[model samples]
Target: MAVERFPVEASHIMMFARSVGDPNPIYHDEDYAKGAEPGGIIAPPTFVQASSQYDPDAALRPKPGQPWFGSGREPSGTPRGGGGGGGGTGLHAEQHFEYHRHLHPGDVLSAKTRPGKSWEREGRRAGKLKFSETITEYFDQNGELVITARSVGVQTERVVEQA
Candidate 1:
């Protein structure tokens, strides 16, 4: 995932925190955060994931003229093809985050991702499984590394049709 610019705003911090069921004042209350160690409002631990909204080509976002299966202004039908439950798109197996520093409001962040390692395994019930890792590093306006996110995606052998 590569995001050119992701501006961290105070309101966005509060909303993301609330959406994740976090009630911490450090995420919303500026006055309360002023007395804290960071001295200002900080984003939630997983708030960086919200950067996907800024990524125009994010995998989860449907392409133009493509049909999506969720609610929208107009009704659409779901695509049907894969039957083994993997749906061919793979599954999110794991997520890990490393925070170099607390993200404060007014920080313009950017992210760049690189592929990690790939491995395969045999699943007792699910059959063949392939796992791949993606490491994304988020940098601040000053080009300082602010956070690192490691994600693992797993796909079943059934994801591909046997021909």
Candidate 2:
């Protein structure tokens, strides 16, 4: 995903912190943060993932007049397939983060993402498993790297059995 401008506001930090069940005063209380280690409010470590909301082309976000992804009258249908070979199931394998510094309010961030390494392997329950990585580098207003995030995705010929 490409993000031209993602403004980090205090309210957004608080909301994100709350959503993640993080109640640290350093995330909400300005005065407490003023004397804390960073000397100011800092967003949670994984808050950078929230940038997806600002990415207009993000696929997970439901637009107006569109059906919600959650269950309503009936259970939400199964998820669609992944990339690589068509009609395969997609799954998030893992996520890694390298933080140069804590995210603070008033910071404007931009992200540049590129594809990483991709490989294929055989699975027990699933047929062929194709693993791919996407790396997104977050830069601050000064163009300094703030966070390096790596997301791993897998495309399986079929859904793996729960173990």
Compare the candidates by lDDT and give the number of the best one. 2
Off by over 4 Å in 1: 62-65, 69-89, 157-163
- Model 2 local distance difference test score: 0.88
Query: Which digits, one per residue and each the tens of the lDDT, describe model 1 over residues 28-84?
Result: 999999999989899989999999988988867877897776557646446544455
**Per-residue alpha-carbon lDDT of model 2 for 20-64, expressed as tens digits?**
999999999999999988999999998999999899987788777
lDDT of 1 at 51: 95
TM-score attained by model 1: 0.83
| Alpha-carbon lDDT, every model | 0.87, 0.88
The global Cα lDDT (0 to 1) of model 1 is 0.87
TM-score of each: 0.83, 0.85
